[model samples]
Target chain A: MHMLLNTDQSLTQRSEHALKDSFLRQAVQFTTERLREKKEESTNALGDWELWRERGRQIRAHTIQYLDYYLDQFATNVEQAGGQVYFAKDGVEAAKIALEIAKEKRAKKVVKSKSMVTEEVEINTVFEKEGIACVETDLGEYIVQLAKQTPSHIIIPAIHQTREQIAQLFSAEQGKAVSTDTKALTAFARQKLREAFAQAEIGMTGCNFAIAESGSVVLFSNEGNIRMVTTLPKTQIVMMGMERMVPTWEDLEVMANLLPRSATGQKLTAYMSILTGPKRSDEKDGPEELHIIIVDNGRSKQLGDPKFQAILHCIRCGACLNVCPVYRQIGGHAYGSVYPGPIGAVLSPLLNPEDEQVQELADASSLCGACYDACPVQIPLHDMLVYLRERRVKTQGGIEKVAFRGYSAIFRHQATFQWMMKTLRHVQKWSVKDGSRWSSFLSRLPIVQGWVRSRRLPYSTQRSFREQWKMLQKELEEGVDNQ
Target chain B: MNREAFLLHLAKQLGRPEIRNPPKREQIGAPDHWKSFVLPRKSERVDRFCQEARTLGAEVHCFETQQQLQEGLQALLTSLKPQSILRWDHTECPAMIDSVLNRWKSRIVDPIADPSQALHADVGITTVDFAIADTGTLVLCSDEQKSRGVSLFPAHHIAIVDADQIRTRMGEVLAEFRGGKPPSAIHFITGPSRSSDIENDLSIGVHGPAVLHILVKV
Candidate 1:
C-alpha cells in the first residue's frame, strides 16, 4: 500500500492532471454520493450512529494510548491460545519475516484475502520474487491484480474498473468471451477461485480486530473468502497493525456494529469469523499452524503527540473517504498512496515524513471538517491537516517567516498599514483586468504560478468593504449632526 | 519459531507496559430507548430476522417435522438446479434429517473429506446450534459432530435450527460460549454470502453460499 511513486513532478502537477480527468471526477463523485446516502440510511436505521461512533473512538483512543499494554497482552494471549505472534518495526522487517516464514514452510502457493498492511509491505511482490505463487482470493483484489493496477478504493479495490473490463479479464481466463452482466462475470470468477482456494499451501489474512481477552482474531468479510483462507490452508498468517487490538470481545461487539454499518451499511457483514488458534488436536478443517504479525510502521510516532494521536484511532472504515470533498473530486490515485482521501492526506505525509517531498500533500485538503464528522472514531483530520501545514512552514523558515513578520509589523502601526493599502489600491488600477482589479496581477504573480495555472481567482471589487462601510458611517453621523 | 521466543520478541518491541486506567465503556449500540426493544412472538421475531436476512438474499423456511424438512431438501437436490448439495457429517445422524435424506439420490457426505466435491453442490445442509434474534445470526460450533465446510464451502447452505434454541439477543448466545469450554470454532452467520466488490454493486454468493436457507423447526 506504500509503493513509492516517483515524485518527479510536484504534488500540484499530479493533482492538476487528476482534477482535469472528467471520467475520474464523475466516477468518484457518483460513487461517493451513493455510498454516503447508503451510509446515512444504514447508520440511522441502527439509531444513535454518533454514539456508536463515539464508542468506537473511545475504544480505539484508549487502546492506542495504552498500545504497549494491549499489544503485550495480545501477544501473550495469542501464545497462550497456541498461536505464534511477531512484532515488526516497519514494512521491510515485516516483509522479511513473512518471506522467511514462506521459505521455512516451503510454500508453493499462498492464498491471501485483502489486507492493506500486506499491500503496505508489498508482501505479494516479495513472495513472487522468491518463486512462490501468491493469489489474491478477494474478488476485487483478483480483478485489480489481473489489471496490473493498484487498488483505487480502500474497500472496493477495483472501483475504477468498468464491468466490461472485468468481463474482459474473466474472458481471458475462461478462454471464451464473457458478458458484462454482473451475474455472468461473478459466476465465472467464483468457479475460477475455488481451485486456487483448494490448491494454496498457505493462507494469509488481515485482522479486523485482535481481541486480547480471549486471544482471538476477528475478521469481518461479506464474501467469506477469509473463512476459506484461514480454514482451508495448512498454515494461516494474519498481518495486523499494532493499533488493531481491543481489550475484550465485548469491545469487539461495539466495533463490529460500527465498522460494517459505516463502511457499507450492512446490518451485519454476512460472516463474522473469530479464530482462536489453529485447528486443535481433534478439529478437522482449520489450519494446522497460525501466526499473527503485529506491525508498527510509523504508528508509534503518534503515540505521545496529543495533536496527531487521534489519527491512530481510525477503524479503517473509509467513512472519511466517502464524505471528503477533495477525494470525491480527485479520486484515490492523486494521493499517490494506498490510503486515500482525508485520512490519507493526513496519514501519508506523517508516515513517510520526507518533508522536502510531502509538504504540498498537507495543503491538498480544504479543511472543511467533513472527514471529522464522518469518522467513526472522530479523528480530527481537518485540524491535523492545518497542523501539518503549520509544521511544514515552521520547518522552512523562508517566505512564510518573512511574510508573517512583515504583516505583523504593519498591523502594529495602523498609519503604515493604511498607507500601504492606499498605495496598493492606486497601483492595482494599472494591473486591472477589464473592470476587475488585481486579476491580471494575480495571474502574473510568480509565487502563485501553480495555483493560477490550474484555477482562476476572483478579482477584487471596485471598492473594499471597509471603504464602503466608512462612507456609510460618515453619512449617518452627518444626519445625526443635522438633527 | 517457538511460542517462547515469539513472546519475548513481542515483549521487547512493546517496551514497558503502560498502567491502563479502568476504561469508560460508552453507551455502545442501539440507543438508550431501544435497549428494551423486543419483538412480540417467536414467529414475529423469526419473520423480522428472516426478512432482514432475505433482503441480503438469504432464503427462509419454516417446518414442523424432520420429514417436511427432508422433502423440501429432496426437491432442492432433485432439481439439481445448482448441481450439488453439501451437508455436515452430523447432519446425517440416523434418527434425524439423515433418516429421510438417505432416500435421496444425491451426493450427501461430510464435505471436509472431499471438500472439492462441494464446488457443484446444489444445496448444503447443516444444523445450527443456536440463533441470535437481535442480529439474526445463526451460530455454528465446529467439532467432531459438525464440519465448518457445510456452512461455508458450498454454493447454497440449508441451516437447520430448532425453534427452542432461539435467543433474544447476541449477548445471551455469547454468554453461552463463555460459560463452557467452547468448541474449536464458533461461526456467526447472519445472511447469505455476498460482496459489493464491483463498485458497490452487491453480488450474492460470489465466493460462498449464494442461497442461505434457515429452517426453524417447531
Candidate 2:
C-alpha cells in the first residue's frame, strides 16, 4: 500500500544508508535544532505551555471520539456550500477521484501546493500517467519534484538537499546555470511557478483544518502558494485525512494557535486562507468548483482500539521530528513512508498493516518518549510503537523472542535468576574491562547480538544487589553493637 | 465508496452505531487567558504591531489624521510609480483612499476583468476587514466588490487598515464568525509571503506579494 518511496530496501537497510550519509546527518541535526529552539522560545512565551498542549489534545480527542457525527455534519455543510464531497476508502480511490475530476474537467495541467495526502495517494504520479501535468508549487516540493524524490521533511520537504544540489536541479530545469544564491534561486522558482499557476486549469491543496460548521477548508502557508492554487484554478480539489476536522471556527482558533507554533514557532504563517466551497456565483475569483475528498486509508481501523485511537489526533506539526533521537540521526527518508518521525513510525504500520516492511519501523525508535513530550496533541507515540512491536511479535519471532524466552525462564524462579545474575557478574568481572573495546565481541553473541551492536553495555557490577544488601545488613548489625 | 459505507466502517470500528447528534461543547476556541489577554493600551498595541510587522519584513506606516494619510499614501505611491495598480472597490474603504487612487485613476483599470492584466498588475491595494495586532495580521473577507485576488495576484501588496479595527489576538476576530456564514474567502495576511524551505535560507514574496506595505490610519 506504500505509494511513493521504493520499499525494495528494508527499513533497517534504508536507515543504514541514511546513517552513512554524513551530509544528511548534519543537515537533519541543524534543521531540527533550529526548529526546536524556536519552538522552545515561543512555547516559553505562552507561560503554561503544557496547559495549551492538553487543551489541544482534548480538542482532538473529542473530535475523533465523535468523528462520525462531525464528519457527517461536515459533509452536509460542504454540500450546502456548493462543494461536492467524496469519501475515499483508501489512497488509490482518493487519487482516482482526483484524476476523474481532472479528466472530466478536461484539464491539461494541475497546479498543486504541497499536500502530504496527495503524496500518500501518489496523485501526481497518477496525473502524470494520465498525461496531465501536475506541478508542485511549494518551493520545497518543487525542488523535490525536480529532483524526482519524495520530501524528506514534512514542512521543509527538501531539507536533505544542499544548496549546490538544489542549484544543479534548477539549472537543469531552466536549461541554464542557476546560481546557489538563495535570493536568485527563489526568484527563479517564483517566475517558474507563477507561469504554472496561470496556465493550470485545476488546483489541488491539503486542508489544514476543515471547519465542520462553515464547511470551509483552512490552509496555512508561509509561501502563499496555497492562495495562488485555490484562486488561479477553475476547479479545486482538496484531499484531507478524515480526522482533519474541528467542530467550528471557534475551535479553529485553538488549532490556529497550536499548529503554527508547534511547526515553525510563528505566531501565524504569512497567509491563513479559509475557503468555504467555490467562489460565489457573482464573485470574480477563487475556484469555480470545489471538491473535498476525505480519505480514510486505515484510520478507521484504529477507531475502537483505545491504544491506537489517540494516534489520529496528530496535527502533522512535525514537532516530534525535531525531538526524536532516531529521526535526528537518520532523516525522513529512512522511515520509508509518507508520514515520518515518531508519528510516522506508529502511523505507517497502521496505514499499511499487512506490510512487514512498515512494521520494521516500530523498532527504529529507542522509545525515549521525547516525541510524546514534544507532541502538541500528546499522542503517546512511544507507547504505540511498543504496542506495534507487541502486535508484530505475536505474528513473528527471531532473536528477540528467543532472548525473551530465556529471560522469562530465569525470571520465573528466584533461584534461576540468582544463579544467572551470579554467573553473569563473574563473567563481567573477568572480561568486561573496556565496554567499547569488548562490545564487538559481545556483538558476536547470538541472543544479545542485535542489542549490543549499536550500543556498548557492560554486563553488571562486581557485586549483585542481593550480595550488597547482605553486606549492608552485616555492617549495620556490627555498627549497632559498637554504638 | 459511498459516504454511508465509509461512515459505517468508522462506526463499526468505534464499536457503536452511527451518530448524527452530540452534546455541544460549553466553550470552544482558545484558552481563557489567551482569548482574554490584551495589550495594556492602544499605543502599545500599535507599537507591537509595527515591530512584529517589520520583523516579518513588511513596511508599516501610521498616520494621525487623514491629511497625513493622504500625503503618506501619495509619497508611497509616488515612490512605487507603478505602471498599473489594482484596487478593490470596497465601500468599507474610505472614500479619501479611492480619491487618492483617483489621482492615478488611469492606472486603476479593472484588471479583475482580465486575468492576465490582474497577474501582471504592478500593485494590489485593498481594505482589510479587520486586523490582529498580536501577530500583525490583516483579515480580508471576499465579496463581489472585494475580490480575494486583489490582495494575492500582484508582486507588491498594500493594505489600508483602520486602527480601530485592530484587535489583540486572532481569536477575537474568529469569535465574530460564530453565528453566521463566513464569506467565501477570508485571508489572514500576516506579512509578505515568505519561505524558509530552501536550505534554511529565507526568500520573501515567493508566490504571493514579495513586498507588503500596511498603512494604519489612527
Best by DockQ: 2
lDDT scores of the candidates, listed in order? 0.77, 0.88
Question: TM-score of the candidate numbered 2?
Answer: 0.97
Candidate 2 ranges beyond 4 A from true positions = A3-5, A427-443, B24-27, B39-44
lDDT of 1 at B103: 63
DockQ of 2: 0.80
The candidate that achieves the highest TM-score relative to the unseen native structure: 2
Mind giving the per-residue lDDT tens digits that candidate 1 earns over B1-218? 34344334444444544445434555433344444656668877776666665676667777777688777766765665545566666634436677656765355654655566754566777888888776778888887767677788777788877777777666556556553345657788988888777756778888878878877775
Residue-level lDDT of model 2, residues B24-108, one tens digit each, is: 6765677888877988688777888788888888999999998888888889999999988988887867888887887898887
Lowest lDDT 10-residue stretch of candidate 2 chain A: A432-441
List the pairs of residues colliding in candidate 1. Answer: A1-A119, A1-A120, B84-B121, B84-B122, B85-B122, B85-B123
User: How many residue pairs clash per model?
Assistant: 6, 1
**Candidate 1, residues A1-483: lDDT per residue as tens digits?**
255554787766777888898876877787788878888998888778777777777778777766666766777777877889887878888888888888899999999998988988889889999999999988889999988887777877777778888899889988999888888878887888888888888999998888776678888888888888987889899998878888766677678778887787777788888888777867768888898888878776776677887888888889888998888888887777767888888888777675467556787788999999988788899999999888888887788778889888998987898787767666655565333346566667666654665565444536766788999999999999999
